[model samples]
Target: MDYLLSIIIFFPALASIFIFMMDNNVAKPYGITISLIEFILVMVLWMGFDYSNPNMQFENTFALITTYGINYHIGIDGISLFLLILNAFIIFLGTIYLNQPNDKNHLVVCLLLLESILMGVFSSLNMVLFYIFWEISLIPILYMIGAWGTGEKIYAALKFFLYTFTSSVIMFIGILYFAYLFFITTGKWSFDVLDWYTLTLPFDIQIWLFLAFFVSIAVKIPIFPFHTWLPHAYGDAPTLGSVILSAVLLKMGTYALIRFSLPFFPDASFALVVPIAILALFMVIYGGMLAFAQTDMKQVIAYSSISHMGVAVIGTFALNLEGLGGSIFTMFGHGIISGALFMLVGMIYHRKKTRQISEFGGLAQIMPKYATMFGIVMMANVGLPLTIGFIGEFFSLLGFFKSHPILTLLAGTSIILSAIYMLILYKKVFLGSIQNIKNLTLKDLCPREMTVMISFVVVIIFFGIYPKPILIPIQNSTQQLLQIMNDRAIKENTKIHLQNSLNKQKTALDTLHIQKLLKEVQYA
Candidate 1:
């Protein structure tokens, strides 16, 4: 337990507390050292991880309520493996790459504590435990934004918190109801997801639970209509907060879809797949249109995240190996691509004191290295051939093509739309006459900045050309997830039983079962 999942989850908080006790000058380096240590430990997890095996690994359990068969459980599977690594690695680079005007101790602590809670979200195997981590993760980001953010910071913080928290309350209700369903069928209570995956619930209940969970994921991913909070949150947050939000936090929604929604309610998932795809198609078009219309660099990038995530959602709900595999890959690739973009934007803002596209021009000549790095990362963002972004989008659209050809065509338009906006952004921001006289003296990327951007480029190119390492580990798990949906579609026996159970009258106590469970958890 000392060196396994618990350490990966708790190490950041431990270091954060210690960092708080240190001198202000010492806190940054101390946080960086601990972050690197955490990164190495994740590498160890990866090295020890049997990539050939798709089952959950390094499982650790602690009893929370043995009488109810609920416990604190955490584990990792192939799908979550590299993401865990990405979370640790990006935060490491973030700590070092940080040149924020302020060197406040509380900011560093907030970032590290965020790392710990995010790790908890990715690792938890129990429903209530996962929900707890999910809820807690929002607090650090709120602190970072409200205390350190710029324009509309408090409003953005509240919007982000309220949008996600309100949606999550729905998900929590779904989870509790799911556990209650288990009790009626099995004569006991349990919140273990692995155990719930084995239960068969009514199709009627699946639809309710599916919508409940979908509302939550949609808000987090901010699919189309639910995306109102993103631009504000991303535009108003600090660089590090924006970076983590783009890189890791958004993926939690898609990851949860794969982890909870697909497995737990296969019939309802299959039933709703098309409508979801249509919504995703709208997301791609709408997000791209908004991005194309933006004059501010950060707003464009923020909206672009919405567009790329639309592709990820399409891939995931394809419910095939290619679709699911591509979705996982997209999460990692988008994190890198978007994270690098935000970092570069931060660098520019640091020097220019502006994020306005109109203010920039002729940076390629002034800052040759930074401009070149921007070209490379932007190309990857546009899904250039032999880049990490291409592999994910290609496979996702390909997977979607099998099941929904027409919708896939509409979704694929994002490819051209993304290029148009991104290239236009490049021309506006990096090419043309030097508009501002003061910009002439602007310095190029320094040594530390190059380390971060160059590292991002190397990974993007190497993996873009050869995605075998990423694809192979996820195939077995993705295939298993696909099978669960297929099985639910054909299993008449369970379906019939579930149908029969739904016909029974709801009791007064049945309505209170949820309330009773809520109280138990409140004092548990």
Candidate 2:
């Protein structure tokens, strides 16, 4: 299975060259065919996955840089498996939806390359390999925005690149520092993630190292203060670009928090939990308020993403199984619901040539099917019952409540606020008297677009009704993480206790020796 994971990760990349060479007339069909094959291969991997095991599956390693202690290692756990499937699913559907045979051949080629790098990021077991994939993945997106985006694409792409790139550089240094520490302790040089787990750093070192990693993941998650670039990126990117960014790319950050941050710095994580939760709380409330202030439908969803990610991150820092599970689950839900919402927004933009909510009204009267689908998706975005959105939000809030009941209650405002903004956006666009004459004759979704959206709707509804499949695997993964945290904590406490005992014994021995010397002097 070592090569199996590599094949899945790299095949699309190899296929991308062929895709790039193809004439425009055959590009769409060719892209779709390759993507279908890639997606099916992911399904095959899923069917053969050993659900009972929490350890990395299909593990493989290759010597890439022995001098630098870097190796090309790859594997998947339950947490990553579903995400890989999600990536494949979204890209495949996105290809079908992007059926512009005569246009944007280069864009299709870039997305294929992006898909391959993303798979590598999710599946890589070695820390350095993961970092390499992580950095490489950014190139296509930067190019996508600069080459294919609109309304200040260059500015948006440059900003996106600088923000994420700076963080990745910092994280690389942190990784190297930690790997060096591992070598010093055990006389072995390895950049394997599993090995790093056993190389515990002192408290002060952990704090600084954790910050280095945190900055990178937080920027990726784009939590609150760090989220300035996302709105522009989302708003400027093409429909397909926005969908891929929302559905798959953003998850990279949140997923990193779970995969690397929590395990590597458990004590620091435990200590910073309260402050981080507060930040999340603020992001949830503030981002929703800003969403309501937006006239551009795309910007509304953009701000809403910041708010949703806040909930996801807070759940992650809860450091408990339920919270951690909910964080991962919410990320999954956000990928589907938000991705669909972006697509819907793009559909509106393509038809009306504007994203202003005021440009639409009484769409239900003209386009019933489109209106109905938008309403359902809007409801999910608001975290209404019986939707995938509800599962992640409910569990995340519940997890926060365990430790910070008051913060949990305050953070709960996102649910209400999101509903308010989303519903208002929905009402303005789809209901009320027909304000714009242009909307009266707007075309409804084509079969291809409708099929793509309906597929997402089906996934959201399926998970909402029965999340057991997702929950079981996430639970196993989180349980193992918790065990490692507990073990680390216990060892630290034991070390402190033993040090104190040794100091006490040394003091007592000195006192007894002094008394014996005094008695001998008295006898002399």
Candidate 3:
């Protein structure tokens, strides 16, 4: 079991390198087979996972560079396990949906490499190790987008690289700063996150560190203001790139927010709750409204991403069991549903060579299979009941309602707005009359595409209706985290109250000193 985790993490890289060396003819088939093997390994890991344990499992450690106390440390708990599963499943599904039938060896290798890096990022326990995988993960994705994507792919790729790279550099400094502080106090240097967790830094230090960390995670989550790169990236990316980006990569930000930021800077995090929540609210309403106005199918999903992620951020900041749990659940649901949406758009664009909403109408009559799948995915995107989307959203709103009822009310409007625009999209694309001659001959979903779409819908309904499978493990993970935050909040507040009391006593003494000084002057 110790090496079981390492096998899961490293096997994809091995397979990728193998595929890279293979001929293009062989690479495509071999890559898909390798990915399936990897997926099976993940499934085995899932079955073996002891859900009762909230702590990291399948833990493995090897000294990579022990001089600085850095090790190749990796493990997973409930919080990351599902993400790992999502990463493998999406890549496998994306592999099956490759655009070109020409078997591009390099592209196959890049996708395989991406799976490796994503796995490493999820399983990494050491901060430096995590950071290394973190930075490496972007490179293959950059290549994936630039090489295969349409319409200004290079620009989108560079934007993604720059946004992530710049943010990561700041985060690196913060990591160094914390490690240095720990060294100064304890005569040791380490980049283990769990090690850094114990250092009680001053409030000022936590604030700066929090911002540095926030910049990196925020850029990935692209939480408002910083989210400008996402639409262009997601819109221009190839179907595989778009699916991977939405399904797995973006969640890295939300995951890191839980693993690193919130726990490390509890005081600063608490101070930030209101402002972040307000920003999240703006994302919900603004993103939804922008999505509503979009004519391009890809752009609609891109903006809708912003809207959905806004709710994720709100749920995250709520800082309670339901909120945190829902945020994680939402992350999982968003990955599955958004991936399907993008893939569906890609299918249409593949056949019709156009994504304009006006270009599509009455597709249902011509392509009932595609329309059926499309309708299911669209409704799921809009958070329909008995689907995965509803559970995450329902819980997130429920959680937010506890803290800020008014903001929750505003966030709830996204529900209405999303349904309106998404349904309008479905009607325009699939229903009505075939207004254009070209639309009459459109093909239904192919076997491979049909399989992928059905898989997504099934997972959506499965998790949506019975979320306990996901929720139970997450509950164990988040409960421990919430308790930690609660304890930290209590301790910090108590310390502040005591400090204020002492300041009041000092003020009384100062007043007495001034009065005594005046009496001495009068006596003289």
Specify the highest-lDDT model's number.
Answer: 1
Give the alpha carbon lDDT tens digit for every residue of 1-524 in model 2. Answer: 54778888998889888866777777777778888999999998988888778778888888988976788888888889888988888889888888443555777788789889999999887898899899988888888788778899999988999999998899999998998898889998899988877767777777889889989988888886888999889989888888888889999998888888877877777778888888888789989999999999999998898898899988887676557778988988999998889888888787888998877889888888788888988888888777899878877776678778888888889899999999898888888889988778898888888898899899988887767678767766776776666555434643343244234334632334423432443235
Taken over the whole model, the C-alpha lDDT of each candidate is 0.86, 0.82, 0.83
Model 3 has an lDDT value of 0.83
Any residue pairs clashing in model 1, and if so which? Answer: none
**Global local distance difference test of model 1:** 0.86
How close to the true structure is residue 402 of candidate 2, measured as C-alpha lDDT? 71
Tens digit of per-residue lDDT, candidate 3, span 1-524: 66888998888788777765777778767778988999999999999999889888998888887778889999999989999999999988877877666657888888888888889999998999999999998988898889888899999999999999999999999988888898997898888877776766677787899999999998998788898899888988888888889889999999999888887777778778788888888889999999999999999998998899888888888776567777998999999999999999999999998899999898899999889988888888898877888777776787678768998999998899899889988888878899789787888888998888899989988886667778878867876665555445435663353244234334532334423532443245
Report backbone clashes per prediction. Answer: 0, 0, 0
Give the TM-score (vs. native) of candidate 3: 0.92
Model 3, runs deviating above 4 Å = 487-524
Q: Against the hidden reference, what TM-scores do the models get?
A: 0.93, 0.92, 0.92
Question: Which residue pairs clash in candidate 2?
Answer: none
**Model 2 TM-score on a 0 to 1 scale:** 0.92
Residue 461 of candidate 1: its Cα lDDT? 91
Residue 6 Cα positional deviation in candidate 3, in Å, after optimal superposition = 1.1
lDDT of 1 by residue, 78-113 (tens): 888878988997899899897765656888898899
